[model samples]
Target: MERIRLTGAQATMLATLYGKAMDARSPNSVLHDTMALEAVRRIDHDFSKVGIKPGDASTVALRSLHFDGWTREFLAAHPEATVLHLGCGLDTRVFRVDPGPGVRWFDVDYPDVIDLRRKVFPEREGDYTLLATPVTPAGWLAQVPADRPVLVVAEGLTMYLREEAGRELFRAIVERFPSGQLVFDGFSKRGIKLQKVNKAVQVAGATLYWGVDGPAELESIHPALRCVSAVSAFDLDGFDRVRLAYRLLAKAARMIPVMRRMAIMYRLEF
Candidate 1:
């Protein structure tokens, strides 16, 4: 088994990984991600330290499904597009989506995280690549051919970056790709200040720096950028499938505007 020594925000990935695995094991699994289940069995880390509660599994699964749906939507229309999964940390999205042969997929993250990924996940086929880097204004983005329509997905990443850096990262991608979509989930400013609410972030003792209050915050960045969708947690397609406890929590959150803004998923076209 592969042992891990990641800490801080990087260590938080393990919590999310564990949650997805638990979700996949459930009878009414949201993602039905057997890949995540396999990954947990292969890792030798102490998941208890990550502080993933039973209820957290469905939240992780639903978030992944939301992104996966958008990815499938894009690929169904443009089967030959390029996909850049930024801050990819042990996520089996490529395995789950299983894009067509004409597609080019890149799973990118920090060098150490990429190294851990190789240890746990087996080799894959297709025009797939894993680029390991710090993912700032990510110089590695330059390596990806800008010729095709791009689909950029960043999960649980932007909060770790300073607000300016997050915008800059998006700026780089929009400037490089002629036309494409940027899909990601982000916290409201209130959410960033209340990081203790996120079990993984609390357990990892990680600091979160940025908050995306709404789609207009990013759409203002570039002339070509347009907000395609800005969905709150309650608005996700599979809300009814989420466990009862979280469904109740979402109900209560909806009563308050600040709580409602705590979690949001955004998709933009440029």
Candidate 2:
């Protein structure tokens, strides 16, 4: 494959794919995203520049597990619901989740990223659609059907956007869908600061723009939305061996007020 020049946000797709690929190879992996592994093998880029360290791969898997778990719960409640995967990279989440025949799924991202996805993955028409558009400014939201309850998910996104832009994006989703849920992972102020020196961010040349100290504060983004739950990454399960590592570090982290607010996952309803 020829090398592709990508902006910071677009380059992030590669890092995420690397992380998922690493998790899939692990014996005790939680995400098991084989598609990601295959996609990485087929892509001709030098993945070494992405800076996906072993611990970073574990973090990605843990976050993916949270989103996957929440999605399953939502689908169970509304089997016919439409699922919108915001900033859908080459992670192959649809393949991993397999929401069954009743649901319609749309993967939205930048046009170039979507083009790459089409080339690498087998096309699944009718039930699955690949949409290419900028997530913020949200012009693409008009294309998604809003009549049915929707489950919108954004993983490893949001942090790259300014607070105002991120709020507009969330507000658009809540306004477009009469009833739905929005799930996403966000960094705290401290996380944003730490990201500046994070190897992956350094390699990708990306900036972390938005971070929330408390996940519940995301509710302020839109009047129609309310936070269902906000939990720390350390509180969630599926960490496997890392759970112990997190616990041991928990006390040390708490000593630093900023580190305590590093990462969190949120479930919200509108």
Clashes (backbone N, CA, C under 3 Å), per candidate, total: 0, 0
Task: Give lDDT for model 1.
Answer: 0.88
Best by lDDT: 1
Q: In candidate 1, what residue range of length 10 has the lowest lDDT sum?
A: 233-242
Per-residue accuracy of model 1 over 1-270 as CA lDDT, tens digit each: 888888888988998899899998899899998888899899898787788866678888999998999999999988889999988999999999999998999999989999999988989988999999878966888889998999999988888998888888888999998899999888988889888777688888788999888888989878889998888876677778777987888888888888888889889999
Candidate 2 lDDT over residue span 1-270, tens digit each? 535677687788888889888878887776888888888888888887798865557677888888988999999999988999988877677877888788989999889888889888877745898998889888888888888899998888888889999988888888888799989888988788888677778888888989887845787777778888877776667544454565577657657666656877888898
Candidate 1 residues lying further than 4 Å off, grouped into runs, are none
| Runs in model 2 lying further than 4 Å from the true structure | 243-247, 254-257
Alpha-carbon TM-score of each model against the true structure: 0.97, 0.92
User: How high is the CA lDDT of each candidate model?
Assistant: 0.88, 0.82
